[model samples]
Target: MINQNVTKRPVRIGLQLQPQHMDYATIRRVASKAEELGADILFNWDHFYPLYGEKDGLHFECWTMLAAWAESTSRVEIGALVTCNSYRNPELLADMARTVDHISDGRLILGIGSGWFERDYAEYGYEFGTAGGRLDDLATALPRIESRWGKLNPPPTRKIPVLIGGGGEKKTLRLVAKHADIWHSFADADVLEHKLGVLHGHCETVGRDPAEIEVSVEIGGSTDPKDGDRFRELGASLFTVGVGGPDPDLGPLREWLAWRDATNE
Candidate 1:
């Protein structure tokens, strides 16, 4: 069980405006509305095609939209919900992140994960290697990304926070213990409890404090806001709610934001 005193970080709500099934104008509008509604972070996912709905629906790329978000939003932190590590060279991705960090005045979270979605690999001409191989590649890429951040001319505006998304008990949790500033997953309370215990073991093995990594839980569209209390008890401080668009609804997001405020108070 999580100790309340140990999980003292302020609760934060995030909005992931899935960049599919909608026009760019609609995304920008929703992003603005979410920030106005007080989302602590804004996220978009990285994929070549739609994850759901009409197969050929309108979609946008992740980093480019983030560059636009950097210029447009004044206060919200922006990033891919998790960029696929296999998509670009690690050093180049680091530079891109640093550039965006400066553009956003250091409000960028470098959320990333091992590549999945085989269609993305096949269509983009990247090798569709085994999951273990992909995770190994991600393991190799992270340090290069960190080293590149150090060597960049202006450097990152700050030590850009690394948010790693995955729950693979053996490898992913180990990597999170070694590197991640925030660890994200879509697990329910029971699953999260089990995973967090695994994560703590990894942290102990790595000689790191488990509490240093903030726990982030993804809030599903139909998930009840009260459920966040259970997550909080498991040490999740950041809750991200995802909405897809032709036109997305903001009402549930508003409810989460209110919960954040009340829970924090």
Candidate 2:
């Protein structure tokens, strides 16, 4: 059971349409279906190639597909489950996010991280540097992203919500405390509880309210709402279900949405 004090917000569900082993047409169709089915957010990942299946499997770029999703879906907030920071210049990425925000009429969440995927870096001509270095760059890039958003021609339609994905106690959570509107992590309930304490500590250090940041977690394939009980009890409001491509099934997504609706009510 969720503590009444902690789970204050309405439960929201997200669908990550993995852009792997699928044609553009299929991806587009699924995006449409996800929106029609009442997803609060629609997400894709930032990667040059498939993360699983065949290494040479069919895949698509992240932002361009987000642009398409903006044009296609009227309601769901759209973005990468997280865009990798090293893939593009932070200022340019900020501009791109602003553009998509306009296209979606102010419904874009700028979910980002200090990128991993070595293959994306090596093949795309980016420096596949040390993890610590990448985190340093992300720490540096975020302010520039916000500054760029301020100077844009027309500016973003609204203050775009920043969603930071990662669980590093020292660096990542600190960044989340300083900048993020939402903090996403893959930690299970026990781990999430510990991380939330770390996050709250970071918030205190940074002079930000920890309650201002909505917690997001990956809810695995189980359709039973009981499977999400622990996470819900810990105050994870935004739950994401990932569906893969090339004839993907949305049954699980539907189940999760039902869970979301029931919980919210």
TM-score of 2: 0.97
What are the lDDT scores of the predictions, listed in order? 0.93, 0.91
- Residue 249, model 2: lDDT of 86
> Using Cα atoms with residue i matched to residue i, what is each candidate's TM-score against the true structure?
0.98, 0.97
In the range 153-188, model 2's lDDT, one tens digit per residue, is 999999999999999998999999999999999988
Q: List residue ranges in candidate 2 displaced over 4 A.
A: 1-6
* Clash-forming residue pairs, model 1: none
Best by lDDT: 1
